[model samples]
Target: MKSPENLLKSFFAERIKGLVQSDIRRMSRECERLGGINLGQGICDQPVPDSVKEAAKSAIDRDRSIYSKFEGIDPLRERIAAKMADYNGIRCDPDREVVVTVGSTGGFVAACLAFVEPGDEVILFSPFYGYHRNILSLCEATLRFVTLHPPNWSFDPADLERSFTEKTAAVIINTPSNPCGKVFSRQELILIASLCQKHGALAITDEIYEYILYGEHRHVSIGSLPGMEERTITLSGFSKTYNMTGWRLGYAVGAAPLMEKIGLLNDLLYICAPTPLQHAVMAAFDLPPSYYDQLCADYARKLEMTCAACDEAGIRPLLPQGAYYLLADISGLGLSDDKEAANFLLGRAGVASVPGTSFYADPEDGRQQVRLCFAKQDGDLEEACRRLRGIRTARP
Candidate 1:
């Protein structure tokens, strides 16, 4: 008899299997096994917000146990709409233009399938989030990479513009970006928006990190541009904003027709977001502005603390204007390969980090970089820093 694994489809989607199982998770698992402090996954090293926990409790108590309309209920949708209008400054009709999904991850995957036909090319700017590659693969779309050259993870506009083609179906922007913590400037966004509009393509903006920005930088949505809202799908979640990753609540906002189609797609894939979790999101949107102010303040403190350590290590980092992550160069330590350095730190120094090499399709693009999430308590950041400082390559 043939092996069970051999029974799977041949000529199967090559892209699906090509993805590395989020390197961050693998490192987190190793650290857990060894009882080391984990900073690999972007999950909060803090407590779940009391309001969200209470909302979840309230939902369960109210017997919110049945399936909901596949597009989500009116109250939660209205709350989401209001949140967008108030914060993102884009007014949307909740009933016509919104569909709640499992998380921003789901929203992105569904949007990718909704917008991309097989063989369509999508432009990705790296170090991009890890899951974008997975979504592109599952959508069966071809990827064109645009790299961000460091110490400042900024791209040359001419290089990025050259990557756009008539075959280009969509362009994605994530800011404050995932690994680099660089928030794109307004002029940069306008340039991208103009190109997409000129070419009749779509822009998908992942704003899941909206509230997590620090310093003088603010998170701006490409959909917020003069003529982009109709063609853009804004993806965001309660996961990062509320320390509610496990809550699995997120939303997609776009034009009514596009959203209607995505709603149908969601019906096929998930039926609707978890009914109880959707109910909980209503309370999330109503959080006072003070709550957000404090959240930003807390993250700013963490950013400075961690990057200061990187500075002390004799590596000057591109100070993050937003987002919770800071990517540091490993070359100063005489390390030539990030994967080798990451393994050494995890095994020898009792620290774990995502190698920047895993964030790019071609390892050569980011071989000398490492991504560290500063979304930790002070004690955790301090301990990790101390461990990282102890690296003495002369022994090796």
Candidate 2:
């Protein structure tokens, strides 16, 4: 075999280079090995639903293992299109309007490669998902983001407007967002949609957690607004809602012209998502609405447990509106660097959490915050609370 150095390629793509293995997974594995509770990544530690697993089994049993069609089989595409129109009121032609991807992450990568060429400007919000920047960077887009409004972890339309310029190619908006878990209210969506329209920029949304919303926080698709459907690439997947991260199945909907290019990237990069997973996703969409209702209620319970634990421990969290993550300020702990503080917790206290800096383009903006995922089981949450309380009391 050739030497490892010779086997490697040159300094890789800038975006891919900036992307790194998540520290959340690293810390969580250590916790698991040490017999500790882990609330690190948003991946659900629960088993995949029997129904979807059955679908996968059925596909394999029938020997339907050929490479799926370039745009995915008609049933999957039709299911996605109808579901989009039903839930978000955005009607799209199934054949020409959707692309099935390996996961929402893959869909975003394909979207960026298709629409955002080298040097194109892509905007996102701070405390956003790390992969958003990873995908943008992979496509060589100049990254821009608006910092979250303090304490509430909400957005200011003015800050969003200021970020826009002629060089802008697209804006990525996530509701029921990661880190903060703040769902963008309809008014927020309207303002963002207006700005995108005013500037003629594409709006690429990561709506993977749309179904886990709580109380009054409705998950609004930017494309649902008048005239916005044509310019928006709406992304979603079964990873979170169906607890199928390993399934690696997601789909995106947009105008035919935009989707055609995304399809090309999907063909070359992924060769269509795994066939059995696509079959499983079709099963996921057909499940009863009660499945979603129960999932949301379950997520709300976990959210409450985490917030109450934080309050009991004297840490302030700006109440998360939805999603499975919550952000906490670490300045009260007398630590200037949240990353350092997180490392300290990992090494000393056994609480694995993601330092917010890794998610933002400007590390300084996320310096004071850390994100904790609450998607673990109830016992895991209880154990984590006990350990965190011990750490908080012992810190000098």
Residue 287 miss distance in model 1 (angstroms):
1.8
Per-residue CA lDDT of candidate 1, range 1-396, in tens?
656666674545665566556788888898788777676778776777788778888999998968898888889888889889988888899999999988988888889989999899898997788888777877888888888776567889998889899999999888878878778888889999998998888998888888877657777788888999888999898888888788777889999999998899888999988998788767777678899998899988887777777666654566666778877777776666887777766787677777878887687776877778878878888898887666653226
TM-score of 2: 0.92
lDDT value, candidate 1, whole model: 0.82
lDDT of 2 by residue, 263-284 (tens): 9989999898998677766888
Number of the predicted model whose TM-score against the real structure is largest: 1
TM-score of each: 0.94, 0.92
Backbone clashes per model, in order? Answer: 0, 2
